[model samples]
Target: MPGRIDARLQELGLTLPVAAKPIANYVPTVRTGNLLVVSGQVPMRDGVIAYTGKLGAGVGMDDAQAAAQLCLVNVLAQAKAALDGDLDRVVRVVRLGGFIACLPEFTAMAMAMNGASDLAVAVFGEAGRHARSTIGVPALPGDAAVEVEAIFEVA
Candidate 1:
């Protein structure tokens, strides 16, 4: 039988992609005690960056938000892999770190990050209400519009 988290994902029509491999030297996730830390994930789909460019330049608000949501999806993929494919092992969403690639004048970082936050709560309920940090950056790996990383407390 599918776990609660898996059922929730299906109910929401969200399908996590395969966990992405590290592009650099670091592993995708590291577990120390009950804490699982997921490295930053960009908006990659089918092995390619799905969203690119700075937010205030060519990317619109909706696309930037979608990019943020996709980043979270990737983060969840890594977490699922680390937990033996059982998302129900997650106890709490400790924190989320978001980086938005945007022009210097852009100041909608919070709005963009809401994409991930909303989805997190949707997927994990109260456990997904987490502390978060969102910042605007000049660029990110693969020139992705957004990147998200997370720390999860697991069983």
Candidate 2:
């Protein structure tokens, strides 16, 4: 069965915010074949960037995790928007990629990414669990602690 992403979000005490319009030239999501490629998402709440800074430098690990979690929330919001409010169309989380802006030695990128991974699995069961790569980067937009992008297979 396709996942009940909306119900799962509510179960987690979360309500996805409206998807944000792209700030630049790119679209928020793209569709090709049965796949939907969601663009990189930041920790945005309402219409503003919620968390900003570098991990292990300007932001703590806990806050980084929260920031990553918020990015996932935006991913879901974008997905719903792409599908016109029908989240049931998502079949699986195909892949995930995250960039963590961090100090030279910080190695907690994957740990922060766990917030998104945990949400995926909780929402989609086994299908939401997928390949992921989380790597430390020198900088991200708004100097956010973390940013995440997702690829999903639609039903």
Candidate 3:
């Protein structure tokens, strides 16, 4: 039988991709005390950089939103790995940090990040509601349109 969270994911048609290995010195996830910190995850899917380019230059609002959602999926992947596949152990989504790659004049960073926030709520219910910071960046690793990192309080 699938875990409760896994079932929820299924119902939403979301399949968490395998956690991406750290490309540099940092680990993908770090657990300290009751908190798990997942490193920034780009919009990677099926082992490819699924979304790339600056939001205001070429990427549309909807695509950037999807990219944000994908980044959070990777975040959950890391969290699952850190918890030995037990996503139900997640107690709360404490915080989320969103980085949006966009032109200097762009101002819709918050709307783009709403993609991840909406999914978080769908997956964790009230516990997924979290404090968040969203910022516009000139660039990101792999030229991905969006990156999202998370702090999760877990059992």
Candidate 4:
């Protein structure tokens, strides 16, 4: 049977993609004690980076937000893999770290990150309310418009 989180995803018309392989030597996730730390995920879909370019440049606010949401979906995919496909093992969403690739003039990092935050809450309800840090950078891996990493407390 599907878990609550899976059902929620279905209801929202969101489907987690296959977890992407690490581009470098680092693993996708690490579990220590009760916490699972997921590496930063870009907006990859169909085996390629779906959203690229810097915000305030070619990437618009809508696409940036979509990229953030996609990154969160990838993060959840990694977390599910780490927890042996049982997202219900997740006890709490501890934190989310967002990186927005943007030009120097861009200042909407927090608003862009809300794409991921809102979905996190939508999927996990109160358990998804988490501490977060959003940063603006000149570039990110694969030049993705947005990247998101997560710390999950699991059973």
Candidate 5:
């Protein structure tokens, strides 16, 4: 049976991917006390980088937003793994950090990150409303259009 969070994800037509392996030496997630820190996740779907390139140069606003959402999905996957597949163990989404690969003139980084932030609120309800920071970067790993990282309060 699916837990509440999992059910919400299904209702939203989103399926968590297999937790992605760390591209470098760091682990995907770390749990200490009641907090789970998830590493930055890119827009990967089914083991492939789904969105790449600079946001202002090639990727449009809608596509960048979708990429941000995909990054959140991967973040949840890592959280699920840390909680033994029980997403309900998550009590709160404490914070989210969004990295946007874009041109120097691109100023919609916040709007792009809203894709992930809005989905988080939808999935977790009030618990998903969280502190967030969005940054414009020249590039990200895999040249991904966006990357997202999270801090979760878990039971």
Candidate 6:
């Protein structure tokens, strides 16, 4: 049996979306030793960017949070792909980096990132907790509302 990730997803009424394909020359994720470094994930589903806009401007805090959730979904999708859909190989979530294109006055970046943090804990248990940086940016490609990257430990 796999880890509790599937159950957790059912509990949350969410399903991990398919991992987004690389837009440029980089891969979606890479593994080296015990670490898996995941590229930044934008809020895309079904090969389409679901939310594309700046936070605190064209997008709201709620929208940013949802986009952040999609980012995590993409992250998990990448992890599952890397582990051959066997989440049992995961060990820990090392770190997460989130970037939001938002208005300078927007002060709820952390709150928006709760989506990612919450999902991590739900899927990876205590190991999901990690050091993170949630920073505001002036703009992002495709005018995306949020972006997230992560590092994970694996067997």
- Could you give candidate 4's per-residue lDDT for residues 1-155 as a string of tens digits? 99988888999999888888999989999999999999999999999899999988989888988999999999999998888898999999999999999999999899999999999999999999999999999999888999999999999
TM-score for each prediction? 0.99, 0.94, 0.98, 0.98, 0.98, 0.92
Report, for all candidates in order, the number of backbone clashes. 0, 0, 0, 0, 0, 0
Error of 3 at 142 (Å): 0.7
lDDT of 5 by residue, 1-155 (tens): 99999999999999998898898999999899999999999999988899999988989999998999999999999999989999999999999999999999999999999999999999999999999999999999988999999999999
Worst 10 residues of 6 by lDDT: 1-10
Error of 2 at 32 (Å): 0.6
Model 2 C-alpha lDDT per residue in residues 37-142, reported as the tens digit of each score? 9999999887777788788777887788888889988998999999988888999999999998888888878998998888888888898989999999998887
Taken over the whole model, the C-alpha lDDT of each candidate is 0.96, 0.87, 0.95, 0.94, 0.95, 0.86
For model 2, what is the alpha-carbon lDDT of residue 117? Answer: 88
Candidate of highest lDDT = 1
Worst 10-residue stretch by lDDT in candidate 1? 60-69
> What TM-score does candidate 2 get on C-alpha atoms?
0.94
Error of 3 at 72 (Å): 0.6
Better of 4 and 5 by TM-score: 5
Model 2: lDDT to the true structure: 0.87
Q: lDDT per residue, candidate 6, 58-93, as tens digits?
A: 788788888998899898889889888877677899
TM-score of 6: 0.92
Q: Between 1 and 4, whose TM-score is larger?
A: 1
**lDDT (C-alpha) at residue 20 in model 4:** 88
* Candidate 2 clashes between residue pairs 3 or more apart in a chain or in different chains: none
Cα lDDT of model 3 by residue, 1-155, tens digit: 88999999999999988888999999998899999999999999888999999988999999999999999999999999999999999999999999999999999999999999999999999999999999999999999999999999999
